[model samples]
Target: MRVLIVDDSKAIFMMVSQMLEEKGHVGIWAEDGVKAVEYLQENSDVDVILLDWNMPNMNGPEFLEKNLTDSFTKTPIIMMTTENKPDYIKKALSLGAVEYIMKPFTNDILFNKFELVDEIA
Candidate 1:
């Protein structure tokens, strides 16, 4: 699957990319939500998106609004953030997020989540 990691932190991008790669998933990088949107525009084949909560050009929620309203790309979004409040989770899901992963997640956890997601879908 073509997975896009949109985050300001390079370390997080590298970690997540490496984890997904280990699971035989191709990973793509975007520094912020703005670039992520452009990436989706150029590579509409992307199956999943991992978006961080905080970014420079546009935040996760802001980017999601555009994706929800824009006609181009409305692919599934998986939020990755440190925020663990129920309200935040509810908000992201309300905005059409398919899943939410807390910060500092390991490859094993991610793999398990993916497995469950696949089964549920």
Candidate 2:
């Protein structure tokens, strides 16, 4: 799987990238939603997007709202953030995110979410 990881922190990206690599998947890093959108325009083959809720340029929910009418909407998005509130999760799902993974998650949790996404797809 080719996963786009949209997060402001390099450390978090590195961690997720390593996990993906270990599982034989490719991980692409986008510092913010603006960059993610730009990348998506040129490369729409991405399997899934791992989005962060509090980015500087464009947050996860903002990205979800903006892409609702775009072709990238076909790509499944999983909001990965520290926001663990039920309201936040519900809002994300309502806005177009297929799944939500709270931050500080383990590798098992991350991949398990991926499996859930596959089932949904």
Candidate 3:
């Protein structure tokens, strides 16, 4: 699987990419939503997106609002954020995120979440 990782933190991206690599999935990262959008424009074959709520230039929700249309409507977007607020989670789901992953997560937690997305997809 090819996963798009959108986060501002280099550590987060590295951690997630390493985990995905261990799972035999390829990970492509973008520092923020703007770069993510640009990457998506060139690589629409990505299997899923791991999105961060807070980012510079373009946030997760704004990214969803801008790109979740036409061919991208049903693409799976999983929110990987430090924001634990129920309202925020609800808002992200309402905006088309398939699931939410809180920060400080373990590889097992991330793998389990990925399994869920795979099942649905």
How do the predictions measure up, each by TM-score?
0.92, 0.96, 0.91
Q: What are the per-residue Cα lDDT tens digits for candidate 1 across 1-121?
A: 7788999999998999998888789889999989988887888888778889989989999888887799556666788899999999999988878889999998887777666556655
Candidate 3: Cα lDDT at 79 = 93
- Evaluate residue 5 in candidate 3 and report its C-alpha lDDT on the 0 to 100 scale: 90
Q: Candidate 2 has what TM-score?
A: 0.96
Model 3: lDDT equals 0.87
Model 2 regions lying over 4 Å from their true place: none
Clashing pairs in 2: none
Q: For model 2, how does the per-residue alpha-carbon lDDT over 9-87 read when each residue is reduced to its tens digit? A: 9999999999999989999999999999999988877999999999998988889988886756478899998878999
Cα deviation at 17, candidate 3, in Å, is 0.7
Q: Give the residue spans of candidate 1 off by over 4 A.
A: 119-121
Q: Which scores better on lDDT, 2 or 3?
A: 2
* Worst window of 10 by summed lDDT in candidate 3: 66-75
Question: What's each prediction's clash count?
Answer: 0, 0, 0
Name the TM-score of candidate 1. Answer: 0.92
Tens-digit per-residue lDDT, 1-121, candidate 3: 8888999999998988998899798988899988988887777778889999999999999988887563443568999888899999999988888899999899999889988998987
